[model samples]
Target: MSKIESIDAKAVKTYARTEQTVSDVRSYRLARVIEQLKISNCPAILLYDPVNIRYATDTSNMQIWTVRNPSRYVMVFADGTVISWELHSCEHVWDGVDLDLELRSAVSWIFFSAGHEVESRCATWGAEIVNVMRDRVPGESRLAVDRLDPMGTSYLASKGITLLDGQAMMEMARLIKSPEEIVLMNESLRAAEKGIERMRREMRSGITEQELWANLHYENIKHGGEWIETRLLASGDRTNPWMHECSSRVLQKGDLLAFDTDMIGPNGYCSDISRTWTVDETKPTDEQRRLYSTAFEQVHFNMDLLRPGMSFSEYSEKSWKIPDLYLKNRYSCIAHGIGMVDEYPSISHQVDWTTAGYDGVFRSGMTLCVESYIGAEGGTQGVKLEQQVVLTDDGCVPLTSTEFEMDWL
Candidate 1:
């Protein structure tokens, strides 16, 4: 076995910014959306989803907050014109930033102050969208919306505008990443690696799992990361049965600490990497070695099986089989597409695919996260391993370069 090479955060960050213009990446993404709209025969898109808004406008302010608040949104026309709406005075969030889109304050005073005329607010927004469509799309135009409140949907239907599933269109557009998007993802991965390095250095027995988790957050934010997607960190017995979020549980000497960094870093790309580390300076037990080694092998084995032009169904059928004993606690999917985070086209194990999977072909430029978790139903501990990679013309290239903990093996 060869030594795994790790990424140099500073170098990657420097190269990402210098090698590509952020505006160009934004344009590339928007162009993809436009292409998808044409294919779907939709003339325009009403993007209320913050992720889709960021994808179209290349700007975000209070993304997580806006997820439920409905304070901001964007509209993209088939001709590639973008109209961005922000809450009153919130438009200043992008004060000095350079962007290529029209900006406006969303009409939401009624909904915000009175809190009763939700339909009125939706009507006003729908009217504004109709006006854009009439001016930009000409005759018999249809509008696509990724998601909308019921009132908004009703308002659009009353206005006689056809609504298509904009979410599906956006997903199709985002399936294959552009070169610049890949660059931004690499930057995100490096930033995540920096966070992992901090966590590893601060790992020690007696420290609370939450305390160790903070180290990763500190490093990520210090380097301009946006937000962590989840708090799935656990130690010792908490590692089994999975999905255990970070708690105040103190680490023991021989405990295994497993974490999944479901984070959105620079440029809003996700860097999802999982690792299980031993807390003490002492060696892992024989059983610990077996679990970790099995997980590590499973992750790499599936990663190796990835290639361009493979049908999802075919891949699912041919992928490695989990031993029957470990199948009960196995992860939902052998791998999943990663872009903004767990995007699309999940490749489940053969035994699990019929009920849990979807079919699509793997194309060059698609980014994927290969996942593995090894633990028995009543096991005391488990190992979680994942690798992020980009599908190339002939094979896949790893985006995450952090070395697995060789000591555990």
Candidate 2:
């Protein structure tokens, strides 16, 4: 079993967006940010999260690396003025992108880059940011910020800057999608489905979980995806508890392999789909069949409950009622908004609504994921299933084309 059969990845075709479509989406995203900024009465927004930066300006640098190291950032004024501080002289990354922004050299302030000069570096960074605040926001000291460390916050505060909740503002802005965004999202989901298909074709006894997971990564990148957010692939006994990441354990016949593809695909949009399949495509035991059927029921049941204008609480109340035996191991969220990443309004389960729930309306053009995890507290194996969809005035329409294992049941 050491020598696995060779597998070829299927070619993934995505929509070829025209220059006009790209320009339209960029303008729409910027307008949404400006609308949020004006609504919050903040003159500008300070973006550190690469995803948010990409939303504001269609430029992507070191996304995962920049998360830990704030190497780049952007400031979007309520008037739609964009000041982007790129890493060093790498401003050329935005060369042909249909966007207009004042590019400047980023002042690297993290200790890994600046070392002992972090304090002085903060002085340099704070000065530039302060100038923007003063110039763009006259008679206004408030600026929305998605993320910033205490040192940066203190320095900016010392310079008469007031920070608002930019994450909340941005979430509200990105909650609803524009027409052009949906086209790009279709392309992302298409690439993700191709990756899932490759994973399915390569699924077999003796294949390590890690090895199988790499196929997904390979297909994603080969087909224009950006990156996967996690390695949530587990097999057999590991599947019951859920949230277990993929590892080196080899697959065996009749084992259940569950995974959540939280992929950042083409155009930085996410295609968060989850599924559970049997290793070697073997006939599952009765218990495995039961587990998968229950999870499948939960996913679609909740998905059918979604509609535009429904409140989160109402949705939670009407969501699938997880049986008492599996309540403890249920997926944390019944549904959540999805866009460039998992965006606003996480709809909670009925029992968990009190603490984790908030109020929000389901709006047209909002993408969401219906999640399920079915397993008793000490069960031998579990099943996890999820579906990504677009919420419209009539109902929800699924985005992922990856098939479920209905025959196994």
Maximum-TM-score candidate: 2
Residues 78-118 of candidate 1 have per-residue lDDT tens digits of 78877878877877766654555688888753455438876
Per-residue C-alpha lDDT of model 2 across residues 1-409, encoded as one tens digit per residue: 1100111112111334787878889998989999998888888999999999999888999899999999899998888878888998787888986555788889988999999999999999999999877776667899899999889999999999989999999898898887678778878888888889999999999989999999889888998899999999999899979989999999989899999999999889998999898898888889888888899988888888887788999999988899988999989899888998888878888898788888878877788888999999988789989888877666777777788987965
Off-target runs (Cα >4 Å) in candidate 2 are 1-16
Top candidate by lDDT: 2
- Against the true structure, what is each candidate's TM-score? 0.93, 0.95
* Per-candidate clash tally: 0, 0
True-vs-predicted CA distance for residue 342, candidate 1, Å: 2.1
Q: What TM-score does model 1 achieve against the real structure?
A: 0.93
